[model samples]
Target: MIKHSIRVTPNRKGIWFIVNRGRIWLSAKRELPQGTYNELILSAEPEQFCLIGQLGDQDAYLLVNHDHIANEDEWVTPRELLTVSEETFQLAARAVQVALFLQTHRFCGQCGSAMSLVSWELAALCNKCGHRCYPRIAPCVLVGIVKDNQILLARSNRHRAGFFSILAGFVESGETLEQAAVREVKEEVGIDIANLRYVGSQPWPFPHSLMTGFIADYVAGDIVCQPHEIEEAYWFSFDQLPETPLEQTLSGQIIAQLKQISGNKKAT
Candidate 1:
């Protein structure tokens, strides 16, 4: 089973954190310092503070601001936290998402009134309009297209040179996850796919995205790369695949699964 170090809970305070823009303040040991939530809340004001969750035995609090804290020993981005540990990355991602949500939804959209935090849950309530706003999670699809021992991979213009991975795209409104996968493959590489089996999902919080994974069979059409999105497209043999993303991502997970299946067939 997967282990999570941080647990979601109602507002309480034991450990203090300050977030400026997207960077988080960390101590010399690359850890969030401990401080009283009550004191921090009083000084920082309730609007600037958010109760993220419980980290082990302490309650984790986040202070969101546009200005940096001079008292902080070090400042690091969420990507930097990934280098420390998976648990740290998870916590940092969650914190950043919550912080961004709070920052963006400071006022009610329906009514021009300041919103208030709804205790016992992760949401904001507008006293005037009674409108509740929750954190946003954009759903996306990542697919690995396999044909015999070859898997279809594409290099996107956004990715670094010498890196390629599975086809992916954001799910449009009123579209099913399966439909999104099929559409993404068709649009990016100009091919049809079948047997789109669901593999797994991963929370990719570059800006709060939940990526669902799939493995599909190549159906028809030659690879005609999408003009702006795909830089190159190719079907790679299992033994001659290009450098891809790490296993921590859904695309990597899909590729790893295909490699294992290909290896098993070769062995048998």
Candidate 2:
């Protein structure tokens, strides 16, 4: 059962780091400690990653990168990000996720008091008041709306100019994740869906969000993209599916399953 799923790597201690200008670097091999990374102390543990900011950035927490790095630039030299594995992104994302929460919760929502990290737990303690704060991740439902023989997808203004993604929205109060899934499809693409099926989920910590994926049958209505949210939307035939964007994620997984199921039905 677990053989096909993504596995996360554990963070170990005693790893030497290279702090070039500002960013930190992790070596490729466990024993190879090359470059200026050896000079800096292990400020946080292996799982903890740093949130870079200006002076007096009290809200910043740490994030750890164990995966092989993917992107490395001179100015934002992400040594760890460059050398980590694909599976490690989940761990790194989790670290940054906590930091992202801390960053946003540094100030008290109740009394505007500055919050400090709690040593015992993953929370912050307010200085002026007794309020304890923690990070938050807004829940969102991303769905693939399918009809007779096609799936509905749209180009988002939220992403890069030409990138298209599944219809999605933040889960509103009093609504279950499933309800949100149906509502989001209606609000974004002006379509109703049935046979709501859970696909999978991803930890999208670009600030913080738990993206729940679903595959729903398009019941009716024309593809009317909501303004400010969706720019263009259309149903593409399964055999003639549009060029899917890069990155294998929850959305990608949903598409893969859809293709498999659709194909099996045709054969039978």
Candidate 3:
């Protein structure tokens, strides 16, 4: 239900945004009011901009391509921006999502024509052609594989320390979400999974992704980490699970759920 639910912070905070010939420019909310109008970003920013309503709240995130953060390292973990509220983080994440969508879809794929923002609705329309492009959410699956009392998880080469997660991959061209989950497990760690059951999903707007969650039982196979993709793979007993990264994300939720289920089974 988290996908259907987003937190609305408080009020409107000015976000200074710019688009040069339709490319987003980033600037702080304070600096944006004084700059030329193009595209704008209106989201939650306690120190920079005011906290605003949640995304899908009938308020469009005015997206301007401006990088105004004091520290470049701070941009990686977006939840640290301004106020620390779920709603605020959700809004900010969606803002990044919208900006990324617009940036990538600026040009029409079919005819290679320039695209313009639609007057009504959050979509881009081809200036020369009549093509309408909407925001894209790449469908992916995250699975928790459990066998006996231990659970299977992997650490990606891209993740920070202490950040391990369930096996995940993008839904392929002609595969179902469940199929993708199974295939990802095999490809990432050479493991076979069974009893794939849907748990929940999250709108990971960090560059626009919808992560579908599943819990699968480990059938067979050894811990063989995929090269370049997964740095390490391991089986952690119920009593020895590693620390899970919790940034209000789907991966975090699945880890928590896995631990809870394992604990209950041990208790009974």
Candidate 4:
């Protein structure tokens, strides 16, 4: 007698991030569409795509949808995903950045030849010129200055009254994250800081930025807001603070840490 047996496997779902003209598609429930084409909410097939990462044992793909104005309400910017869980926010960050990279690096800068995606890595290569390009990430620093139980905050010229955050600036060509933090604080508020402590880092996808946070001790100098940059600067007591970034952001995290260290109530 002969016996045969068949084994069956469950089909896991993949998270699809459909992007059109920089905006990502969300389900009516306002969530990333999961599964393959069967679960994809959009109708257009992608002309470009990238496997970003895995989420919950399922793969996550970045699909570049065609440029159109259909279902406008379903397409939301990455900023809208800030309230989502950290995992979702992270995938969305990579999706948008990768999409931007694919869109911008379609041609070789050296030979003006068409670029194609590399099979083994997240990069675009030009066969003619042998040139390759990868996603760009700008490094930025967020410095939360502390004096006694007070924290130094500033409102940039671009910010409205009331909303303020820790001092932030981009890392220059030859500058380190620590150097950038100190220089940003000094340039924006005309102050000196000592005893800098590394706090944490966050992926800020406002056009691709990695924010490295630091807690610095206020050493000297008065608040002299830089023109054309800082609208105002002040040191506020931990208990009484103005509007600030959300708790999901690095700035907010550092602020919460500082308040906890001071044994003060959490900021609203």
10 residues in a row with least lDDT, candidate 4: 1-10
- Candidate lDDT scores, in order, read 0.79, 0.60, 0.64, 0.81
lDDT of 4 at 154: 94
TM-score of each: 0.83, 0.71, 0.74, 0.89
**Cα TM-score of candidate 2:** 0.71
User: What is the C-alpha lDDT profile of model 1 across 1-268, one tens digit per residue?
Assistant: 1112333233344776677767788766667767654434223343466556666777666667656566544777777665566666666777777878888888999988998777667788999989999889999999999987999989999988889999999999999999999998899999999998999877667688888999999989999999989999899998998899877656887999999999999999
Which pairs of residues clash in candidate 1, taking residues 3 or more apart in a chain or in different chains? none
The whole-model C-alpha lDDT of candidate 1 against the native structure comes to 0.79
As a whole number from 0 to 100, the lDDT of residue 59 in candidate 4 is 74
Measured over all alpha carbons after superposition, the RMSD of each candidate to the real structure, in angstroms, is 4.8, 9.1, 7.3, 6.8
TM-score, predicted candidate 4 vs. hidden true structure: 0.89
Kindly state the number of residue pairs that clash in model 2: 19
What TM-score does prediction 1 earn? 0.83
> Which candidate would rank higher by TM-score, 1 or 4?
4
Order the numbered candidates by lDDT, best leading: 4, 1, 3, 2
Evaluate model 3: give its TM-score. 0.74
- Model 3, global lDDT: 0.64
Number of colliding residue pairs in model 1: 0
